[model samples]
Target: MYRTSWSCQSRFVIHRTLVAYRTKGMPVPRPRLMLAVILFAQFVIPLSISGTAVALPEIASTLGASPTPLQWVVNGFNVAFAVCTIVWGVCSDRIGYTRSFQIGIVIAALGGVLSTFATNIALLDTGRVIAGIGSAAVLTGAAPILSHLFHGADRAKAFALFGTINGLGLAAGPALSGLLMSAWGWRGIFAAHTIVLLLALVGSMRLPLLGRANTSLRQILDFSALKAPKFLTMTLVPMAGAIGFVTFLTYLPSALGAIHSLAAGATGALMLIMTIPVLIAPVLVHRVLERTRITPTGIVAASFACLILGGVGVLMLLRPDLPVALGVAPMILLGLGFGLPLGIVDAEALAAVPAERAGAASGVINLFRIGSEAVFVALFAVILATVVTTALPGRSGQLVASGEHGHPWIYHDGLLAAGITMIGIVIVLGIVFFALTRAVSRTPALGEQLGEQ
Candidate 1:
C-alpha cells in the first residue's frame, strides 16, 4: 500500500510539470533575448546611414547623380526619420511595442527592396524616405520597450548596452559596406539590409506583446516638455553632436577621395579611427556616472567639452599639406565626444517627464536630434556647392558631373568651409553649455523639476 501511494504521487508531479511546460501563456522573455531583439533592430538604422554614406560615390556614378541630388539620398532618410519618430512613438503607446516593432521591420524591408532595385535617383530617394520612416518606428519603440522590460539599475545597464550596440553599428557600418561594395557593389549593401531586417522581424515574434499605454494623440504631440529649460538644454547636446557627426560622415569619403586620393575601402578604414571610440566610451561613461554620481546636466557639459576639442581637430583638416594619418587623428576626439553623452541624453530626457509620457518625450528629443542632422546635411551640402561654384567658376557643373574624380580643389575648398562652419557650431554649443550651467546654479529647484517624474 505504501509503494502504490508513492508511485501515484510521482506520476502526479510529472503530470503537473508537463502541463506547465505546455501551457499557452505569455512567457517571460529572457533578458538577453529581449536585448538581442532590440539591439538588432537598433543596428539597422545607423548601418543604413553610415553604410550608404560610404557607397555614395559609387551610387552617384551608377545613377548619374550630382552632389546635391546625392545629398538628398542621405537627407531624404533623415527628413522622414525626423517627421515619423513622433508618429511611431504615439503608435507604440496605442497599439503595442511588439506590433509596432514588427510593422517597422516590414516597412524597412520593403524600402530596402525598393532601394536595391532602384534604377533612378528619384526612386532611390523614395526608398530611403520609406526606410527612414521605418527607422523612426523602430528607434522610437525601443526605449519604452526596454523601459518596460528592465527596472531601476537594470534599466540603466540596459541603456548602456543599447549605446554600445548602437555605437558598434555606427562604427562597423562604413567598414562593412566598403567590403560589400568591393565584393558585390553598392546594391549588395541594400540587399544585406533587407535580409537582416527580415531575420529581426522573425526574432521579434518571440517577444511578449507588451500592454499599450492610454496616451492620446494630443498628449503625445504636446510640446510642453520643451518649456522645461533643463530638458531643452539636455536635448541640444545630442542635436549639436548629430550635426557635427553627420556632416563629417556625409562628406568625409568624398573629401578623402578628392583631396587625399584614398579609395572607398581606405576611407572606411580611416573612419574606424573616428568610430571605434564610440563603441568603447559608453561603458566607461556609465561606470563614471555610477561611481561618481554625477548629475546628467554636468555630464552633458563634459561631453560638450569633448565635442569642442573634436571640432578643433576637424579644423585641422583644413591644412591641405597635413598628412592623411594626422588629418584623420581628430576622429578619436569626435568619437569620444559623440559617444559619451549618447546613453545619458535619452535617459536624462525621459527622467524629466512623467513615466506615462516617456514615449512622447523621446519622440521630441529625437526629432531635434535627427531633424538637426537632416537640416545640417543640407546646409553642409550647400556650403560645399557654394564654395565649389565660387572657386571653380563655370566648371562647377563639370566638376560635379565628373563622378568620383572631381577637381581636387573643390573638395579642398569645401573642407575648408566645413571646418569654419563646424568651429562656429562649437562656439554656439559652448555658449549654450555655459548658459545651462548658470541656469542650474541659479535654480536649485531645477533638479526637483527634472526629477519630478
Candidate 2:
C-alpha cells in the first residue's frame, strides 16, 4: 500500500510539469501587425522632436530670446528626455509594457498642451522639458516589448521596421516644422504636439502587454547591467554615436540655412534630403550584412571610420560655393553608420538582461541613449554659443537675433568645428565597440546565453 501511494504521487507531479511547460510556451504572435504598431509608437516622439526644429527661429524672435537661450529650447526637451528614460525603463519593468507606454503618451500630451500657450522662452522650455520626460517613458518602454513580441528572422525584420520609422522622424522633423511654419508661423509646429500624442495614445490602447519581468526592482536598477565589459562597451559607444548624431543633425538645418542663403522653406527641404537616406539604409544594410556574412562588430568599426570621413566632408561641403547635394553626401555615410549600430546596440541591450527582464533592460538603455543625446545637444549648443559670441560683432549678432537675417559662412565654420568633435568621439566609440566584440568571443557565456531566450 505504501509503494502504490508513492508511485501515484510521482506520476501526478510529472503530469503537472508537462502541462505547465505547454502553457508557458503557448501563443506565438502575428509579426506584421505587431511590428507596425510598435514602429508607430516609436515614431511619435522623434516626430515631435524634429517637427519643432524648423520653427525655432520664429519661436526665438517671438519670445524675444537671444541665440544662446534659443538653443536651450531644444536642449530643455532632450534633457528631460534623458533624465526620465531610466525611470520609465524601471516603471515598464515593474508595471508592464503596454500600460507604461500609455502613461508616457498621456504625459506627452499634457506637456504639449501646456507648450502651445507659452508667453515666452522660459515657459516654452518648461513645456518642452515636460514633454521630453513623457517621450522618454514611451521610448524606453516600446523597444523591449517588441523584443518579446517577435523572435529570429521576424525579430530582425521588426528591428528593420523600427529603424525605418526612426529614420522618418529624423528626416521629417525639420521639413514638417517648416511646412507648419509656412502656413501659420511658429505656433503651427506646436500643433504636432497634440497630433503625435493622440496617435500614441490610440496605439497604446491597441498594443498587447506581455508577462511581468522576473527580477527584483533593486536588481533591475543596479549598476550590474553596466559592469560587464561588453555591456559597458555597448552603452558608451552608443553615447559617442549620439554625440556625433546630435552634433550634426541638430545644427544641420541651421547650417543649411546659412550656407544656401536658404529661406526657412528652402532650409526645410535640405533637412529632408539629409534625413531621407536613413530610411533607405536599413533594407540595404540588412541584405548586405546577411549576404556577406559579415560580423556586426567589424561593420560597426568600419562605419565609425566612414562617419568620421563623411562628417569632415559635410563640414567642408557645407559651403556657399558648393552644390547643396554635396553637403548632404556626407550624411549618407553617417546615416548608414547610424542604422546598423542602432539595431545592433538595441539588440545588445535586450540581451544583457534575462528574458523576463527585457523591458527593464530596454528602459535602461533607452535612458542611456536619451540622456546621451540630451547632454550632447546641450554641449553642442554651449560650444556653438561660445564660438558664435566671439565671432559675431554686436551689430552682426542683432541681425542673427532678429531671425530675418542669414549667416551661411559662419554657420559652416561652426559646423566644421562640430564635425571635428564628432570624429574624435567616433575614435573613442570605435575602440569601445571593438573591445566589446572581442570580449564576446572569449566570454562565450555572454554571447551564447544572449540568444537562448
Candidate 3:
C-alpha cells in the first residue's frame, strides 16, 4: 500500500513539473517540426489559389464549361473560404487548434479527391467549395498556433517566414501546376494537392495541443473591430489588393495563351516573372518599415501608389500595337506594387485587436479579402462575356474557340474592357485609402480609443 502511494505521488510531482515548465516559457518541444508542419499546411492554400490559374483553360476545354462557369471554379472556392473562415476560427477556439487543423486536412483531401475524379463542372465546383472551407479552417487555426509557439523577435521572424512562404506558394503555384499539367494533365494538380495535404496532416499529429480562449460564441462573433478606422483601412487595403491579385492569377494565363498562343508551361513561366517579386519584396518592405517607423497608413499609401502603377500597366496591355516584350514589363511593376504590402497588412490589422481575439480578427480581414476576390472575379467574367458575346454576335463557335485557338484580336476587345474596369477599381480604392489616412492623421488617438473599447 505504501509503495503504490509513493508511486502516485511521484507521478503527480512530475506532472506538476511539466506544467510549470510550459507555463514558465520553456521552448516548445520540437519547435522546428511544428513550424514545418504549419508552413506546409499554409503553403497548400495559396498553391491551390494560383495553381488553378494555369489549369483553368484546360478545365474549360475538358468540361465544356463557359468562361463564367470557369470563373466559378475559382470563385466558388473563394466564396466558401470567405464565409467559413470566421466560423472555423471560432470553432478552433472551441474545439482546439490541432483537432480542427487535422479535420480540415481530411476534408480538404476528400474535396481534392472528388475534384480529381470529377467528370462535370458542377461536381468540380462542389469539390472546390468543400476544399476551400477546409483550407479556411487550416489557415484560421494556424495564425494563433503560430502566435502561441513563438514570441518577440522569434514571432516577427515566424510571421515574416509565413509571408515569404505564402508568396512562394503564390509565385510557384502556377509554374508548378503548368509543369504537372503538361506532364500528367489537369487532374494531376488536384492529385498533388491531396498528397501534400495528407503529408502535412500526418506531420501535424505530433504538434502539442494548445489551450483555448475562454470566450463564448457571441464574443468570438463580435466584429466591433470594423468600427475602428485603422482596422477598417487595413482590411479594405487587402480587399483592394485582392482584386488585382485575383484578376492577375485567374485570367492572365488564359489571356496570355489566347493572345500569344503560348503553351501552358510557358505561360506559367511568364507568370513567375510577375510573382517572383512577391517573394522578395515582403522581407525588404518589412525591414524598411521597421527602420522608418512608418505608420500603417503611410505603408498603405505607398502600396496604393504601386497599385496605381500596376493598373496603368494593365491598361497598357490593351494597346493593339505594343510589342509583347514591352507589354510584359508592366507586370513587373504590378508585382512590385502588390508584393511590397503583402506581409505587413495582416500583421498590422491583427495588432489592433487584443491577443485573445486574434483568430476572429484574422477571419474578418480575410473574409473581406477573399469575398472581394470572388465578387470581382465573377464581375470580371461577366464583363468579358458581355463584351465577347456582343462583339462576336452569331459566332458561338468562335466564342467557344476563343479560349484556345482563336485569333489574338478575338479576345482583345473583351480584355480591354475588363482591364479598364480593374483600373477604375484601383482608382476608387486609392481615393478611399488616402481619405482614411487623412482622417486618422487629423485625430491621432481615434484608432487607439476605438480599439480600447
Task: Pick the TM-score winner.
Answer: 3
lDDT of each residue in 185-284, candidate 2, tens digit only:
7766776666767875775554555446444445444455565566666776457656765457666666665566567787776676656655666566
Clashing pairs in 1: none
Worst 10 residues of 3 by lDDT: 1-10
TM-score of each: 0.82, 0.79, 0.83
Which scores better on lDDT, 1 or 2? 1
Rank list by TM-score: 3, 1, 2
User: Compared with the true structure, what per-residue lDDT tens digits does model 3 show for residues 245-339?
Assistant: 65666667767776667798887788787787777777788788788978656767777776677767766663445555665667777677678
User: Can you give the lDDT of residue 86 in candidate 2?
Assistant: 72
Each model's lDDT: 0.70, 0.63, 0.70
> For residues 1-453, could you state the per-residue lDDT of candidate 1 as single tens digits?
123322343334334434554576544344567679888887878777655767777887777556556666777776787778778877877788768888888898888999999998888888989998898888877766765555444555566566556556765777788777777788998889889899888888767666464445455445677777667777787777766665666566667776666787787787777777777777788888889978666666777777767767766663447777776567787777778787788787667676555655655665576567656766776777667656665534434422245576566766668657865786697687678757856663433653564
Off by over 4 Å in 3: 1-29, 147-160, 210-212, 217-222, 286-299, 318-321, 350-363, 393-402, 444-447, 450-452
lDDT minimum window of 10 residues, candidate 2:
1-10
Which candidate, 1 or 3, would have the higher lDDT against the true structure?
3
Candidate 3 clash figure, as a count: 0
How far off is residue 201 in model 2, in Å? 1.7
